[model samples]
Target: MKDDNLGDSLEYTTGAEAMGDGLSRARTSFGKQPVLGILALVASMALSIGIIGLLDAELFATWVTFFVVICVPVHIVISMAWELNYPSFSRKLKQPLKGAFFMALMLLVAAAIAVTVHYAQPIHAGPPTPFVLMYVIFCVLVTFWFVIVWNCWPLSSLLDNRLLLGLGILAVAYGGGYGLFTLLFDFDAMSAAPFYSAAMDPGGAFPAFHVLAYSVTTVSVVFFCLLFDFWPITLFPILRAQPLMGLVSTIYILGLSAAVYWMGVEWLDMEPVKLMVNVSIGFLFGSLIPLIMFEGKLFGNLRQPWKGIAQCAVAVIAAVTLPSIYWELAPLVSGPLNSGAPGYQYEFWMASALLAMTFPIMVVVGKFLDFWPLRFAPIR
Candidate 1:
């Protein structure tokens, strides 16, 4: 009787294994999470609205930005944790939520640095220190909340492996790009070489110019890298949800940069151009680059040599020409108008035309300099 029972149990276990495999194959082809999990996301947004409504007007806006910069990831983590720990939600929700939670954590560290600076400087007129502190605290709370969510929603075996690989690749690419740029180029290599050197010396340059230029440039670089990498981890949902998602995403990014710029400049009295450039740089580096990278190919084998060459060409041209564009345009709009207001008008149009012309220049440059070993001279 004991031997018969053992054989029966083994047969049941084998059957369950076969069933699991079949379900997973179906999920892979369909590529969506359980519908209920998406509803939970809507509920989370409603909760977020309640929280924001409690804050004062100025604080409310900051709260909204905090939610945007921080909370979405928290929502994902919460869902993941729920599904992981309880094993109740559809397994599809678990992986993306987990990835989002991790990303939120990374952004938290970056935000902490930003907040720290916000407090240290007497930059804003009305004492923005309190607002910055609240933002930081909220971010930390959200991170922990997501940790709980991650505990709840355990991912399927397939998703767990994929998430790990995706994160690893992103980390390697970011560090590698930053390291390469720092090592290869000196302050003299950039158009804003003087500004770069000034930033390092005993006393930094004026706050406005520094903030504007550095912020935008940093943003620009990040986004540009992201675009080139073509990470479908972010792209999959995007492609599915909206037909014009790319344009929408680009506009959203650019608008966010502009708003951040306006705040740094108009509110905090930073130089407009400097703030714009820095914000642009940050967007370019963080999101734009990654978007460009991931746009065309989904699950395609990575291209080599030419990919790196194209990135180099774009980066170099952008760094040199963008500043020149800014420098040439500034005087026309702001400088005292003499008899040649018309000439200034012409210069404005000419600069715009030149900036537009750089697209073809990029193509030409790519052809000539795309090869390795500094054919004549490197882009820097």
Candidate 2:
């Protein structure tokens, strides 16, 4: 009896040790290859773009409108779901019910905006049955893609007490800026020839509001989730510092805007001044506005006065030189896509490709650059 009991205890200990080792190995394997993960994400996005591009012009426009107005908000809800269920930090909201409420509120607001815009320009001719069926298929495909590839783990740790604050800031900055600009200027005339308009219009299939919705949704998602939550870059030791991270993040976003402008000019035939304005708006929404609103929460912990000052300086520098840098690099990266040949007609495809090209650039910056002022300071 004593020998049997001893044997049983030994077997349990051995099994437990094996399980622990297996879990450790699994974590190391998944956690180490961020570049691989990013590449996979890029491929998935490209595939989705390709698939979505197959729809006819009108159907395509409608699908994109739906995606922009509905799917984008759904993505936000999904992110909030992750936060509620699988929070990675101590500061996150603990109550699932509260998280659900926030999610519901966000969706409701987004839906309200979408419904208002859609009704404002009601389609007198309802879409064909085939078109509706295709649109449903496209939505299904996009949802699967988002769930499988874009539902990143980094978002689980991205929030803090400042999330609601950040959301408020985002709303005021975007809403106020857009409203003020439209009030003061003829946006339709100014933006008529812009790349965003061309892409969103896609043979003049959508109204100006549809274009606006698409641009806002795409920019918000790309900034808040994709770029901000870029794991490989965010994990870099040098970039873990507050000010340095802020600077690099700002530069990266500007670079992306430049790339978009380049594509707009080379592929979509957008006017330079118009593209400039668009890029400026993008920079405002994606970088400057968020920075002011989040109070550097997007860049992680500051915990120092000097860090705040440095971040401000970087922001100013980025704002001043953004145009010059955009013009300089626009041609270099835009050349390949131009090639004196017609590029992808669909806007989503071009946008996806441009985004993919930027990923490698981001990886290079994250891997090689050491911008931290104190070389010996421990990485956050």
Candidate 3:
């Protein structure tokens, strides 16, 4: 969801000529770029709000689920693994336009998943909500274990082609996701279509919401690590290498998220789903502005922990403030959503809009296209 190993190549300049015509990484002929960055963020925000206005809140959440289920994996493939290796895949359309094509493709695949989940219910013999709510969302957390935590290990070695590698990784993601879901999540908590079904329940060790909350919070923990440039762990050289770093970091993060979850839920009496949406994913979504939209350059020069701390501060501020605004607007925009009270919970529409919809739009604009419409140019 953030830029990694990507930047426009720039030459170094020096000495007497440094101030002359020589170009530098920090030098630029691109004029008035911050304005364009602001505009891109604005466009994404407007699109997210417009979508909420257009759909019923429940319907909005359904599609949001669809996007989370498919879009993140697709992004890992095309953007992260493939690194958009084939612009010709879209007939070599110029950038920004080409990026739009890629985004559309991810959406199309998500829609396909939505259709299958909806229709397969006849065969599965239960409501589709369980699949969407449990397997799909957890698939996100599971896949991150592969791509991010595992660094796409064995598979990255075994699969050479980008398409094949992506498919393999996604397979592992969903396969592992299903395994974890079956192993841990107690569907009894939601089996009666928001009511408990103790008889039909899978009777797993952890409540579905508990596992779900922890999984998502774990991802946010990873983002915090990334914000620190994989710090503390990255501080150690031997453990800084691939699988070891991933393994150690994953263990550390899982425990960290667990502690955070435990304190928030047990000590503070916060709801799991609410905490996931408002704190975990919401913080990541808010960090997107500084991290993605501005290319993280705003803090690029800062040293570890301090930089991470500063960004976390910004994320906390956004997490606290934006959701309140979204909540106020949700009823008016999405039309009569419940206030997320038990038995009538529909409040996640706004949070989902911020995380699933707005976040991706920002990624498309800022990361994938290098903030297109605002080129990085040489100093004149």
Candidate 4:
């Protein structure tokens, strides 16, 4: 009887192991197909954009201008949350659908609150309550749809794994930095108030400029240059080191602002002090916040602190100088500007210049900085 029982127990254990292995293999197979995920994402974004365009073309244009800027951060936040709490929702609900629904619901609630808080006026305008309610509802629905699409889409190929840490960094740096700026500069009256009014006025040039500058220059710098591949990660090796990675990246970003100022003065014929202040503010939103959030993933693999700092300094100098040179030469290829054009020429020029700045810097960094001496230079 004892021998028979032992045999049965071993059989049961083997069967369980086989089942677990099969499940793991199935998940791996599903996760590995990134093409399918990208297709899904494209389809979802198209559908969402189409719906919004039908409702309000101007607002749709605003979103299109900042599509990457808005989507990447939201995707990072959601993906991080999903990764950290993986399988809990799936197991508890006995399916992936329930888990997805739960995530969508949470995001919807949060989005509604944020939209209402940001948009709702304290003084009652005519039928303000109904308008606020409708806006909140719309925001919630959009957020819910976004969460669903993100979860269903496989973004592992496009984004880094340590996104949670990145999200935390953004929340602290951009959120905190913006708050500080507002307090110091009376941002609400000077910028925010005007921005809010302009955003509502679809026909206004200020609206276009506001969205273009914020999205293209400030937002794109962080999203593409730092988070995406537009700026080579090799430019800043300290991004991978521990303890001081965030601090160092922040400082390097601020220093890069000075370089941008120099370019604005030399190439764009802009005022030095104004450029310095503007670029510094831009850095707070663009490079500094994003680098601290996304690039700090390098810290986990870092071993040497001093070498990281040295590499970071070199990166700052290279980032500044290379981009400055590009800006100076960009006008040769740029066609004549139509001053009477409906859109703001300066906004377009700035966006073009910033985009141009990324390519040359990326080429230089990727070609020269990826070699062994630099590759192993980060020490940790």
Candidate 5:
């Protein structure tokens, strides 16, 4: 009986292997063409550049800036999809496709977001309703795509280029630039509005708000892949090879902050430095908290990025709210310095000190709880 069961199991396994091989061959054939993928990417880039020029000719000149900020992310995604979907796309064109496709898709997504925002009614410089829904759909689809590809044919096992760096740079530049432009150009725009909409102000209307959404999407996917251990880049050799993890994480955090502050200034229509002190305090402390706890582990695993993110969000909230509470109660505490010019200085120091204390505590708590079983959980 045992021998019969073993024979049956072997036959089933062989059938499954054959089926998988057939599917892989089909994907490989599709990938080998490169023309379909190439055309799609190029079309996307052309559309993005045209829109940017149309939106604001003076602020943006030539195609270089647009290429870097607008074309890059689209290229990354398109390339990633094609490369990872390989044997379906030509390996010879894989790396080139990554750069090309990223640029093109980035443009397409940017254009789409802009169109959505431009036509939509403004609720204080926020993302258009359609874009928001589309953004969600895009994320879900990409995420699903990522999972299927990773399981079916892991790209990390094959490709090892600087593709991610290009992706990161583009994501940061465009996302950050869009926010800065919005802040400087529009007042009464919600501080968080650009994050949702990406670009609200006409000055930075080319790629628009949804562009940031796309950047977030790409980053999330890459990060998710790393989290699942599909990526050797997330580990030791890559860690030392260029500190890619640190660089990406730091850029993302800082870039996002700049974008947020830029929006806040615009939404409130305040001066460049109106909230300078407050924002600086928050940034300094907020940045530190992550460094303290997840410094080396920032991209240690896939979940580390998200975990660091959660910590950063918590820090920002605490930084903003806690300071307000402290300021309000300062008078009641009744210290000699509380009423003088030095009082402001004292308050600043106090807040900074408080933030300093809070970060390590968060790390410790995180370590103790292991992020509540989410740490060991699989990406799925």
Candidate 6:
């Protein structure tokens, strides 16, 4: 949100209006009807589990890369540009049509990105980790700067068309993300890997996962804090104002995410990659379900610190519980899970499945489907 220079246009919404955005349509639908919401989400997630379970380790990574390269960023675009208002076509359509049309839109965009990555071969490295981190983690990191932190300011006033505005944000995402990626991440940490090299896997300023972990943690903060009615940050109007708000929030959160990630890496006995894949992502999935799917109704009456505290507990619960579930399902889905390189490739595959594959499925079900069958289901 900028100064009064920004206003709500048909193309996009800006300023404080962007605050708690996407909540009304998706949240109210689910918050008011939790049972229905759970039904829809359970159905969607089961399908996701089945699909991931089906793919072998190597194929799963490829599938994760393709799906994430397209879907994760596409969903972010939907949130930032459309504010989760899919099928922005002038007229209305029915259930599957509306959902199908929206999905068609997603697939089309995914196709475009897929084509680019196919031809460009941005990261011709050994695996999709570098590329995926750049595209999904780093790219979206910058996108978060504009869409969430910066409130599309400057651009919000400058660009009138949503498509143009979205494109503008994406330009910054890729461009800034490139610089940030090279600056913050390094794949040479994987020096043990066969693909290690100076050009493609050339190490960055920090170990790749250092930043990756930070970036992922940054995302978690977005869920429990800014998205939670811009809490704590909202307490200070001066800080909440654009530019400064974005600047301060971004820096402080980066500091916090780094600390937390490093601490876990140093203290925990578990494999860092496995811990990151299971716990970090598990928390993220945990955060998404309550916010986007359950619509934060579990503690609707609570205020920020307490509410956020409750949600944090919920996130932890999910981080601990869900991964165990996904692990149990993993063997069934893909026969056996791989631990790491030299044969095992389950970690990255698992990450992609969680972030790229399963995340999109959940969003499509909750947001695009509008909680469909359950929403339409009859009350006894």
Q: Please, what is the whole-model Cα lDDT of each candidate in the order they appear?
A: 0.32, 0.34, 0.64, 0.31, 0.34, 0.62
Writing each residue's lDDT as its tens digit, candidate 2 over 1-380 gives: 11111101100121113224331222333222333333433343344444444544445444344434343323333232322222234223322343344445445655764454444332413432212222222232233222222321122234433344224323433344334323332224325342223222223334333343233333433333232343345668887444454456545554655566557667888644344334433333224322322223333454334443444454445445543443344334333223211222223223322222222222112111110111112334
lDDT of 4 by residue, 96-202 (tens): 34434434543453455344434434443332221222232222222222222222122222333434433443343335433332232221222333233323222
Task: Tell me how candidate 2 scores on lDDT.
Answer: 0.34
Colliding pairs, model 2: none
| Deviating ranges (above 4 Å) for candidate 5 | 1-240, 243-254, 271-274, 283-302, 333-380
Task: Name the candidate, 2 or 4, with the larger TM-score value.
Answer: 4
Q: Over the stretch 38-118, how does candidate 1's per-residue lDDT look in tens digits?
A: 232233333433343354434433333433433222222322222122222323332335334434553564465445435
Q: Find the 10 residues in a row with the least total lDDT in model 3.
A: 7-16
What lDDT is reached at residue 87 by model 6? 35
The model with the greatest TM-score is 6
- Which one wins on lDDT? 3
TM-score of 1: 0.28
Give the per-residue lDDT of model 6 (tens digit) for 1-380. 22422111211222113444333332344334467547666786788887776666666666456655566666666654665443355124555565666677788877776566545554554445454445555676566556766677777766666677767776777667767776777776577775455556535687776567667677766555543556666789788676777788777677766666767777765555655676667777777666656655678688877877876787678667766767667767777666854434667656666677777887777666655655544444
Candidate 2 RMSD to the real structure? 17.1
Order of candidate numbers by TM-score, starting with the best: 6, 3, 4, 2, 1, 5
Write one digit per residue (lDDT tens) for candidate 3, span 1-380: 12222111011111112224232233343423355556777777887788768876666666555655567666656556655554335434555666777778777766776566556443444433544556676776676667766667767655666677767767787677666766887876565475344543556788877787788889888777666666788788898556687689878998998898988889989888778887787776666655666555556568888888876787677678766776777778877766554533554565467766676666676645655655544346
Cα-based lDDT at residue 335, candidate 3: 73
| Residue ranges of candidate 2 with Cα displaced over 4 Å | 1-31, 69-112, 120-174, 184-270, 273-349, 352-380
Compose the digit string of candidate 5's lDDT tens values, residues 1-380: 10111101100121113224431222332222233223322333334333333432222221222222222233334332332232333223322343344334446665654454345534434322323332322333233232222221223333333354324333433444434444333322334543344343344333432333333333333333332332333445554222344454345444544565557556865433324335544444434333323322334344644654654564466457755654553333323333223123333333322332232223222222222222223333
TM per candidate comes to: 0.28, 0.34, 0.82, 0.39, 0.25, 0.83
- Model 1, residue 99: distance off in Å is 7.2
lDDT of 6 at 163: 77
Query: RMSD in Å for candidate 5, one decimal?
Result: 21.0
